[model samples]
Target chain A: MKRNPLVPIVVAAIIAVMLFAGIHSARKNRAARSPSVSGQVHGKDAPDFELQSLEGKNIKLSDFRGKAVLLNFWATWCGPCKIEMPWFVELQKEYGPQGFQIVGVAMDDSSTEDITKFVREMGINYPVLLGKEEVGQSYGGVNALPTSFFIDRDGKLVAREFGLQSRSVFVDHIKEALNQGQPVQAQK
Target chain B: MKRLFLCSLVLLAAAALGQDAPTMKPVVSMAPAPLTTITQGKASQVPLAFRVIRGYHINSNQPKSEFLIPTALKIGATTDIIIGGTDYPEGHDMSFAFAPDEKLNVYTGDFQVDVSVRPLRSVLPGKYMLRGNLKYQACDNAACYPPKQLPVSFEVKIAKAAPAPRKNPAQSPHSHK
Candidate 1:
């Protein structure tokens, strides 16, 4: 008995659909259990990390728990990151009085001297910490530069933005973070 | 027909997964190179073609900034094959939305690099495989990816050098008698 010519194509399509669904489901399960997976980190607790600041001081993300934090991952070689640096400086000054702080993680492979020179050249006002791969992994593997996460005063992740976004977007997220959580005095 | 169907299914699945994960996609790809033929002791240029994925650009061999990682080709060393200078095409100076005022020297779309190769006269005349790596960092309008190296290889057919010109012998006096 001869089979229909369209049988193979139909069977192949079905198998392809099944395989795609299976892989996607498996990835979803993995992301639920692991913090290193991207696209599934929203609304979760911001991963706390300790890194060295340009002033040769150790800073931890948990130290800023009482203040709303804007954690940004950037690189010196990234042109878009340079553009966002100035805006971040202005945002930090504007929001600092409201108990908001912006933290920069320099995910650069350049030497400390070079990064320090760049930071000085940019006139950055926020604390710029040297980024490590493990810290990046905890935040869902920041494969793209200029990734930012907004944390409320309670240390819950409120929003995350990938790549360079408009200044207004950053402002809106900052306002939301400031309004969402209680201050250290109130918690005490 | 069954084999074709299986291959099509596999490719479709891979495409779907790649779309979901942007990091899994390769930003640059090399085109298949044609085997080059060169005579012994003579230099020949091998042209390699590469294409950057849409919506991305890479720094040229000579980037304007010292901090930028420039795209470069590093060929492996071989005793029989003498590698010479690699020629890179000029980069286009373009500015993106992020940096509208300053232009960065970059390469978009398709680019080519020419490698000079010379086989020693003492080497045998045969096909030799050359291996190398193309190192580059890619970025879009707003974000940059880490630098990556793509493995490269090409075959070169070495030809024998031409025989030296034969010298004419002087005629003997006895031949005239």
Candidate 2:
């Protein structure tokens, strides 16, 4: 059988394009499969960002460099978020001086005034920041409410939780991060 | 020729077996109750009710807070209704075997969610729509089904407020009945 040389070249080009597309899509799928912050965050450097708190204070990630920080993303409209707000407040009060800090980034479309009012009503002790959608995307777009990240004293991302988490689960990660010097990386 | 005959026989048996399989269809049912609209002073007492079909549970406003499925509700722009928190009736939680050692949370049987709407001011007499979407991942005892977004729309009729009672018509301080 005689084969055309041009046919082979064209077939090779098609195969190459398909392979490239497949690889690109696979990478995107892998990124999407990475455990979202709502469930767990035992590994991965906590992506950091700076935003103004509801109190009109400049809050930065490096500001809490020497302390273990709990970064919680929540919204006023989310029922679970409201349910978990008090737990974060209690944690801040219990561990504030012992190198512990809770930072709440509210993902809400409402004005800062509304979020501040909600925080006041909830009596949250931790600093609450106004989370913008673009800013939230940098740390993995929060598909759900009550997503949280735990950073250790060494400024390493240690753990993540995707949904409403119990206080004990959060405290355990905080303790581990505080005790360990190295950052925990999320498994691929 | 014998080999070809055997292949034809096997294909016929397979087709017969396939016909014995039961067909399945997506099950969805929704119903809205009365009392959709209320007057200004009577807004706090109004209720918005729904009934879902058997063998399905709609995701409440909260669905683990990890998935992208968001429960949505829309009200008329002109209505000054204050929607209260959604209340989900408790149901038995069933487990599913997603993997060899993984389990998921789900609800089975009938459930109800109550929506309360309060009118801040007198509403112009007209018809309105209340729409809501429940995003849920349904599963039976063994296998989890694909996630579904069930949309429900209900109509409401707002009417003018009734006249108030006379200030001291019946309860006069000096009146003796």
Candidate 3:
């Protein structure tokens, strides 16, 4: 007995449909599981929060309301964070008088003493805050370390960087934030 | 009829015998072996060491552009010791499919990166965390794997520097030329 030639074609179509459904479901699942803060947070007000610094002093984001702020989230365990720490320190020293400030939120689970020791070892001059998971979630759930948010003087969020940023990149963003009051062309 | 059947059976047997046979197993094994080691020293200066498994090779710090495997040492921070700069062994030329346009640099076998930690004269003593990334690609004669960024973490004990050594120990023999 010979089988109908159309049987193979029907089987192939059913297999194709099954594959399409499987892929569609997988894409949806991935979208659901992916972190929400992976992309740029441009054109929105930077979320504000308060945390204690390594020195046990209270640090509030609104305290520097009229100044350009660089909110950097880092961890002692993250390699990229260490690389950019010195650069941030240099920028703070170079542009401090121009209404610029850098706040570092450390995601380290270590005690404040340990964090303070690390900051001193790295020679970080910026304020280092102890980051909590709840605070991180409020700021869009950071998935990677060294995520930085650039806030302008008007309290507008300007830019964000996810990984190691060159000194020039930070400098340029700081300059832009400082010049937000002036009528300047937007340069991204 | 019996003779005809016997002759046909003999022809079939001869045809089967003429076919090619599988080759014997070679004597050498090519799988890479696992590597692990521990070294301890003053927080200011800790000796970094690595052991390579037999049969496999890791790319050196300065691998060719085509090869992505980079050997690195991740050192945890110690009290006042400031650790900076990584020194690695040189690597040889290698090839990969991902970047077919270029030849990659890689090391074959075991390698190590020595890090120097300079502690301030009046710094406190304690354990600190030092972390870094090692980007590399593992490959054999037949194929090369994608570049991988392996996170490395190791501990260093902070202590007073040993008195001026009979052997100016600061001079690293494996210094990168």
Candidate 4:
């Protein structure tokens, strides 16, 4: 049949080039998926950090893209934080369908066992991540208990709260955050 | 004598500053407004009264459980004042849902902590603000909240010992009128 040997060589070269391009793009995607804390101010992009989840899995802030994220810093010992915990649970259920998520970062010095117990008793319905001192600083120094940051869908910081706020205040902010950007990307 | 008069003047000045400060929202309120007088080298009992919010109790300074955050009162260290000691009220033993078998020491309702202040002998007699903070972890039947620090302010005046009364010389046969 008169098939040239050079044809096989050319085919292989094309396949090699495509594979290389695909690998390069995948690496870029991973890099962008894990954002690090860089001390960005409000109106700027929210700095991100990776922390251990209550279940021991590593979680990153950038993993929450395409959704309106409520980053709340709290401790089990904080009374005000407990007062707002119920509201966050409700908000997660109400707005999650519309691409809203609550990521709780407990800036606690207590043992993981204590924190886990608190989370269990509260019946929290969202991701509970452990936050360190540097991570707290990245979110613009959450000195007060129950500090929260409202992030827009596009990953921009929108509003921040330092003390106990009424559920109405949170709902209004969530409404504004939900209205931001486009529909969220489907998760795998 | 000049030091005594000058210290009193300083105390008045500090009182004005204290007036300008806004009162904090109280989960526990201090009682009797912490105004006192302490003598140099002599320990004086400064009773600090605290009333906890109804339906809630706070962990005692020496909590029975190692994990429970203990309530504490600490006078900030300064050369102008020396803290002799403090008599914290014994916390009531109680069990919680989290750990029913483990009894934790806690305080409920109104309690008093008698803090002793011994002004350094060198300290001048004047009005001084006893700066301190009370750290406590509050809890109810259902849940335990994070620990909080309430700033403690006590205004104290240190008075100089009065000179011994001189005997009436003219009335005695030892001296002429």
Candidate 5:
């Protein structure tokens, strides 16, 4: 018996449609699971991690509980990182006394000596800690240098800045986090 | 009807082939064999496909940002073989926290790099292993880590060409001379 001449083309179309639907749904599911936190949102909890500090001490995110945290992921070789380091130092100085802390996670492969030298040269006054691949993964995977996550006193991820944002942007986010501070007694 | 049946068969074969492609391992690794064979004395194309660990991506041959290190492939120098220019796949566009809003060209998952490998006519017949490396800076959505070079060892098997047909001295055009 002879089959329809258009049968193959019709079958191919059906297969293609099915495949497209399957792939699209899979991608949608993945996206729903890890909605890239590319914007500022107040309800999300900041993923906590612990890493070695330059002083050879283990620093955990939970340790900074009840304090507004400005987490900056940077590298010594990043030029834009240098541009923002001094500003970060200044921000830490301005906000440290007010229940605010700046944590610098150096995503570098350089020896401690080199990182230390760069930190000193840049006059980075905040807690400079070493970062690892897993640490980046916890925060939904940071793909760029100088990415910062602003966490309120309650550990809520208030906002995220991917690249080198303006100082005012940093200040504005910090203000939001500070305003979201805990009860007056917790501020002490 | 026969033509339609043939086309359907081809599509099914292609679909199965796609499903059979190997997946990326946890750590960066290279494919076992070149996609195409390398023949001696002739210019043959060899496909070098590197599997980047899942969820992580390396910048394309030309990263958008100057500070980012582009992924590079290099084959070791060998007198027995001549390595020609390489062809890299177009990078997928993805944004990072560092360059918010600006998409960076990168390669994630399994990507193939096609290059020309010419085995010198004089090279002996056997397996020739050439050393190479893929220099890349891996990053996720969160941060970019230090650049790492994954050493690549390419194995090319060369088969000697068939010996020229011998003339019965009587059949040789030069037999008269």
Candidate 6:
């Protein structure tokens, strides 16, 4: 029997193509699985959204264009969110004078009354808006509670943190947000 | 042939690396339930096993705090079968890194829920399917995921009740004589 010299080479070529395709697909999936804030949308303009506040007033993200904003997504059922609410309150007071604003978006299914009660109990000094699914999707899917995004005064997203990070991390991000953007009068 | 072997090795290594990557999403899976057999008009307990992905915990049916969302099972209504109360296992009281001072009642790893099911006496003796949803909210050391409802289903085989003993004649003494 005569053996063909190109038989093995053709087979190897097929396997090589398959392996390359597999690796490329795996890398793409890994990137998709990663959290959006982890280098996916850094330095990009923060997605704007209009949500209803606890006071029944329509609030838009652009309303705080001149102030550095800490957009926090949380829920009543989220234990970690509860743990960080107090820290957020204190930080709000500390940075309010420096044109820094902390805006909370309640992503829970609880009623507005319940969220308001929680805010009152926690002594939340900032505006707490009722979160909508579309709004959350716009911000790259708030998969976990206590997800916070820091936007500069120019409305550019500077940083993002998932889960409950140390208070120092929040402070550092806040300082960076305050320093990066121009200071102007915050709208009511 | 050697090049083919090298390609295979590279593919295996890539798969291993992908598997080792950290997962941010929480997963809760239910094991296949064993079919429960019950006599007509009698009650039987069907145990359903569930496993939460490692490094995450969900609140039990009764959490310590009112604010926390508790896991619950709600069976769908059926015409032939009557769904009774569901019994949940007690959660372990543990503290996480986020809240070191406060202990939360949660269910980690594997847990079981016993559901009470009863078949009506008039129901035909055969297998019936039961379906429901288990609603749970999961959290890890640092973050909490939104509440999700995992679809659940199981089979129940109903058997006919044994016939009652025949009653003796009323005039037993006269009949005997």
Count clashing pairs, candidate 1: 0
- For candidate 3, write residues B1-36 as lDDT tens digits: 775576556545544434332111121112222222
On residues A70-101, what C-alpha lDDT tens digit does candidate 2 reach at each position?
A: 88887765545665677777878887767788
Candidate 2 segments exceeding 4 Å error: A1-43, A182-188, B1-177
Q: Poorest 10 consecutive residues of model 3 chain B by lDDT?
A: B21-30
Q: Over the stretch A40-96, how does candidate 4's per-residue lDDT look in tens digits?
A: 334578887899999999998888888998998888765557778988999999999
TM-score of each: 0.79, 0.45, 0.43, 0.51, 0.51, 0.82
| TM-score, structure 2 vs. true | 0.45
| Residues B41-94, model 2: lDDT tens digits | 454433434443454443444544343233344443344655665555544433
| Candidate 6 lDDT by residue in tens digits, B79-122 | 97899989999999999998899999999999999999999898
Q: Model 5: DockQ against the native?
A: 0.07
DockQ of each: 0.23, 0.03, 0.02, 0.01, 0.07, 0.37
- Highest TM-score scorer: 6
Native contacts conserved, per model: 0.41, 0.00, 0.00, 0.01, 0.07, 0.59
For model 6, how does the per-residue alpha-carbon lDDT over A1-188 read when each residue is reduced to its tens digit?
Answer: 99999987886677677667767766766565433344666689999999999999999999998899999999988988988989989999999998899999999899889999988988999999999999989987888888899999989998888888888988988998898867785334
Instruction: Looking at model 1, give its docking quality level.
Output: incorrect
Candidate 4 to truth, TM: 0.51
Candidate 5 ranges beyond 4 A from true positions: A1-41, A183-188, B1-123, B126-131, B138-177
Model 5: per-residue Cα lDDT over A84-151, one tens digit each: 78888888989888889999998887788888887888888889999998999888676667678889
- Each model's lDDT comes to 0.87, 0.60, 0.61, 0.75, 0.76, 0.87
